[model samples]
Target: MPAEKINNSNQAVAHSFAFVACVTCAVSTAHAQSSVNLYGEIDAGLAYFSNIGGHASYQATSGLVDGSFWGLQGTEDLGNGNKAIFRLESGFSTTTGESLDDHPHYVGLANDSFGTLTLGHQYDLIHDYFAPFTLTGGAGGTAFAHPFDNDNANNTYLASNSVKYVSPTLSGFSAAALYAFSNDAGQFANNRLYNFAANYQNGPFTAGAAYLHANGRGNTAGGAFEPVLLPGANRDVFNASVAKQNTYATGASYVIGDLTLAAAWSRSTFSGVTDADSGAVEPSAGFSNYEVSGVYQLMPSLVLAAMYTYTKGSSAHWHQGGVQADYVFSKRADVYLEAVYQSASSGAPAIINSADPSSSRNQLLIGTGLRAHF
Candidate 1:
């Protein structure tokens, strides 16, 4: 009877171990089947500027290097090599509760092994591939952008109703293309944009080229209109018109040890017009601009950066330069100080008065800020 009792005890212990192993396997499988992630960054700072045209004021701003945004992304395995994926991103002003550009909800999707395509409002290819090489990336938002941001450094050309496609990388090379529909119903050609870019990176060097085209209408006739007496019958003229613009840029960057160098060149043009009164034809006006910049690492967590930019308009030219230093307290947090100055050429329109070519304006800006990410 004692031998029988010993055998029964051994059997019970084996059964208990088997049940625990089964439960562990079930929990592991459940974890593998589900996943969700949350991530974002917040940037804010105080800024002071001298010679802001006719006004002198100090203010706080958000999203200098990278915009403040939060997003949720997830994926689920369906079967075989297929999976389902989605992302929802929202941009907002960190200093205020307002949404970024007043658009709060942005979302999109991806297919396994094919590519990613997103909808709603988004950045152009130039902003995605080239903006990172500028001083704004390292100098804590102190880099000088081209006059009127004609070089696209300030990201003034976000596309609405945009669709973007990014190809899978092959041997350190990848390509992307994007198109934005105007969605103006019958006015399909109005406010439309398209972009394409290709890039290659191997080791410590990277290079890219991109092109952008945009067409839109502007209101230039809303101000008080005065007509001078003419020999012909008095006819009221308005200055509303359709504008076409094109941008092309190429950039390269190389990193050796702790130092990195970068440079870029770009050109832009604008033309086309429509009379506001009778929708008649009108003359077109256009301009071109260029920029270059560099940066260096003083320590593992400290960096110094500078930039120079020149913009040549139809009636004026502009020169701008800036520098800044940044210190990283951690992988996700940093603080920085930046300063930028601008000087215009005689042939360019005055920075203060667009109508006076002889007038010149100088601007100085200083700021300090902090940024964090998760």
Candidate 2:
């Protein structure tokens, strides 16, 4: 145990400690390369509905134009041009402080060159591709959806237990598709959906088309929509379990200077609709909607927009119009004012977003709101 022996032992121990520290630092750096982000929006507003039960009423509203929700999104770099990604979003009412039953949650794998594949509760191709050109899908928000949201352009329902694929853009063109399982052990078709879409964007012009088919519309155990749970008045409009629902849509948009113009068309058909109570098949029905919208930038912080839609059925027709003004307080916050009017030539009551039906065949609604994003 001489001094030289002690010094040699100390140097060996120092080397071992240095090695451990280097390894720890390397591991921490690798972990830090992967990142997660939290983002969301909360929109609240005041709304006035005219002709609701023959009386005008005012109430606090949430997500009138855009849904209010909070979400977490993450991406992990797996190296070799691949990554893992995920998102979870929840919707809530600002007035009642209640949760919205339908929201989007998803996890996925992506490749910079190959494409992206995701699974969970999510929107189909219609909502992603063609809906963007429609007022509801664009900036018009929740209240701008077509009658009944029959075409799902406003994301009225999310396809659960779903698998989706989105291809990378090629020469300004991209495509996406999705399929949802019924999740019923013995009934593969009990509640299933499949959809596909393609889009193209070149400079200031954009266009897209989508198609969707679903079976067992009201089978809660396997389906996303519970038509029977709708309000009594609007319930009958979709109460029956539709054996099959087919929807098709196409949309186009163009930007000229400070003005943007858009147009869209959608058709929906239901076959073998059955009474939820009696389980009796009812007659088939269908509807078609045509819409046009325009948005103009009054200034860098102010914008104005207008939209009109015409819906037609075998015996029903509706004419709807909307106008909106928005002013930006900041990049993450804004205030908006909107007015909507609808005229119907049908015995069915006029309803918007599950609110009470108009006492007559015509209805008008006005709203002012604020939205913040983070």
Candidate 3:
């Protein structure tokens, strides 16, 4: 996903990756060009769930298992191994035809030897480097999203008003860093963000590691992040604002013939947490996640993938599992059937990402849909 590779997302995800895996699996290159191209994906489907606001429900879903977006990408050949690049992407919901968030739009300059530098909305290290190794980052996608995407393995948020740098690969290694400004007067530390990550790939194996820190995460109007951690089901009780947040992760994957295996671990903490309802402050909230997954290309057009995740919280825990079968119609189209399940510690309602919490401690989801890109 170098600036030189206009078609590459720098390992961006499938369905956000199955592009989940490939999207985050490789930072391989594709030749840059001097023309603009229109690209995006549409994923729509029907889903059945055991609990949503305490009721079994069925509904139409969009981007339920993958990202849905459209955008323009262009690069100009600047000669002497130099290039100018730009991208503008927006996410949307196929169900309601409503707007979602914008992707990491950016403008940058690149050189074959010097790497790339860009400024604008962007992704941080958790998503760029470590996510690829998690089920949520690859083939499992939405169905596999870790509880509330606490580690960002599901890319639940973005770094806004930022500057980023990506280095050229050296001996199978490449690295990236990002810094987001608070953009608020007299509040430089409020919602400011910074992160770094590195990845390596050789033969059938790949590994990555990353770290991120945020000051005054959701405590102001600066917009580095929106303070979306789910310490509990009660949003008012678990305020989106935090004084500080730190997270780190590592993961690896290996391929063998038509099969792939992967594992990942992540830890996150939110300090000076507060209850918006009570104006009560707590010491901190923390989370740890462990996951393993596998994918098999049973045929050229049909593939299967599965994953399991265990998450430990300061006072609760959850276990999740999911599987998907995708059948390709062409290079630009596919259909899939998937299912996901979760069981939470006693007294804690089971909740899947993007869905309401279960009335009890268990929940399940089943879905089928079509996804296409151009």
Residue lDDT tens for model 3, 49-75: 998777999989898778799999989
Predicted candidate 2 versus true structure: per-residue lDDT over 216-276, tens digit per residue: 8677565645554221226645577777889999999999999999999999888877888
Each model's lDDT comes to 0.63, 0.84, 0.84
How do all models score by TM-score? 0.75, 0.92, 0.88
Model 2: residues with Cα > 4 Å off, grouped in runs: 1-28, 224-233
- Candidate 1 vs candidate 3, lDDT winner: 3
| Residue 29 displacement (Å), model 1 | 4.8
Model 2 TM-score relative to the real fold: 0.92
Q: Tens-digit lDDT track for model 1 on 11-120?
A: 99999999999999987886697567998888888876665535554768676555688877777666764555666667788889677642222355555466666666
Q: Give model 1's TM-score versus the native structure.
A: 0.75
Local lDDT at 196 for model 2: 91
Top-down TM-score ranking? 2, 3, 1
Angstrom error of the Cα, residue 364, model 2: value is 0.5
